[model samples]
Target: MRVDIWSDIVCPWCYIGKARFERALASFEHADEVEVEFHSFQLDPSAPEEPEPLLSFLADRYGMSTDQARETDAGAGANAEGEGLAYTSARKNANTFDAHRLLHLARERGRQREAVDTLFRANFGEGADVFGREALVGLAEKAGLDADEARRVLEEGRYADHVKADVEQARALGATGVPFFVIDERYGVSGAQPADVFTRVLEKAWEERD
Candidate 1:
């Protein structure tokens, strides 16, 4: 079965969904036969390359008080911890164009999953600036990619079209959310569903494949 997941690197629920999917895959009898692909979906395409403080953005966008934003972040942090991810208070947001480009490069090297995991950790756990070429090169190197080559690609802005195309295709397919999973090109699961839901979808896809 082929599974295509559309997610952004900064999305917390995407990380949670990844953990849930991992749990389901561990028990899947046909896990070895499954192929997974990560596709790009930018949550804020117009966001500046170096975004302002997240709290300020939230305040301006949602007209929320600082206290309300803090409370919401605390809740999100707790939810993230439940899925084995650590949440920190450093507020930084940036355009993820380069991050998605690196993902395509990782896919070409057959290390897309590893790249995804590292990217998530670098962004959420370590608070690395995902939009910066230096950060992306570091992440690629950590994922076993050649740091020099990664830097060249980032500097030249290679794979930008591929990332944009994936985002456009996602919108054409009516996906307006991150962490959307399409199994076997037919079964669509939106959001970070429970592991049981993923397992059921996998089983059904496998049976139909036969």
Candidate 2:
């Protein structure tokens, strides 16, 4: 069984949804047989590489005030906390293309899952500036990737096409948002659905797989 997840590191729901899906996978009878991979998806492709206040970005994008955006983040924070994940309000938002490129490198190194987890934690949990290059290299090192290689990849723009291809694939699959899950290319689950939903789908996919 293969589970390909399309999610952005900066997306709160993607962080929460990953936890939920893992919870389901943890308890699945065929857990050891499941091969899970994370694919890159950018919620804001045109976002600046330099960091900006996430709340302000949200406020401008949704035509809401900063206070309203904070309230919305609070709700998302609460949901993340429900899943035993940390969520801080002072998060930054920016272009994640380089991060996605690094993910492809991590995948080749067999540390893709760890890299994804580390990036999510750095952005949403520790409130680290994941948008910055040095910060990203630190996070990659924390995920057990070689720091020098990670830095080189970022500098040289390695795996850039892989990142773009992943985004294009997401579009071809009709995914208009992050946290999209495609199970065996058979079932598509969107957003932060509950763990039971993931469990049921996992089981169904397992049963129906040829």
Candidate 3:
């Protein structure tokens, strides 16, 4: 079985949802037979390249006060801690197009999953500036991708088409949000559902596959 996950690195729910799904996948009976792929989806395509405080962005975008935005982020952070993952709200928000491009390069090198995890950690855990080119190369290196090649990919704008294609495909699949999971191309699960829900879906997909 193959699972294609569409998500953005900056999305807190995607970070939390990934942890939940992995908990299910790890305990799955046929875990070794499953193939998982990560697809890119930019939550804010028109977000500024220059970084800004996430709390301010959330406040301005949603008509909430900065304090209210922090409260909302705190709620999400609490959820992440429940999943045993670190969540920091003191991060900057910026365009993730280059980060997604770097991930495609990681995919070519058989390190996409690792890269995805690393990016999430950089964004939400350590509160690193993941949107910059230098930061991405460093994160890619941490994910076991070749540092020089990763730099070259980012510098030359490689895998841009692949990133754009992922977004287009997600649209074709009727995905309007991040963390959308398609299991065996037959089951679509939206949102950060509970672990039991994912386990049941995986089992059903496994049983029903030809």
Which tens-of-lDDT digit does each residue in 1-210 have in candidate 1? 899999998787898888888889889998998888999999988878975666666677789997787787777677788877877646578788888999999999898999999988877787667677887898899998899989988999899999989999888888999889999998898999989999999999889884
TM-score ranking, best first: 3, 2, 1
Query: Candidate 2 on 47-125: residue-level lDDT in tens?
Result: 9898889999899889999999999999999999999998998988899999999999999999999999899998999
Residue 191 alpha-carbon offset, candidate 2, angstroms: 1.1
Model 1 scores a C-alpha lDDT of 0.86
Candidate 1 lDDT score at position 31? 91
Candidate 3: list runs displaced more than 4 Å: none
TM-score of each: 0.94, 0.98, 0.98
Query: Residue 139 error for model 1, in Å?
Result: 1.4
Question: Which of candidates 1 and 2 reaches a greater TM-score?
Answer: 2
TM-score of 2: 0.98
Order the candidate numbers by lDDT, best to worst: 3, 2, 1
Q: Report lDDT per candidate.
A: 0.86, 0.93, 0.94
Off by over 4 Å in 2: none
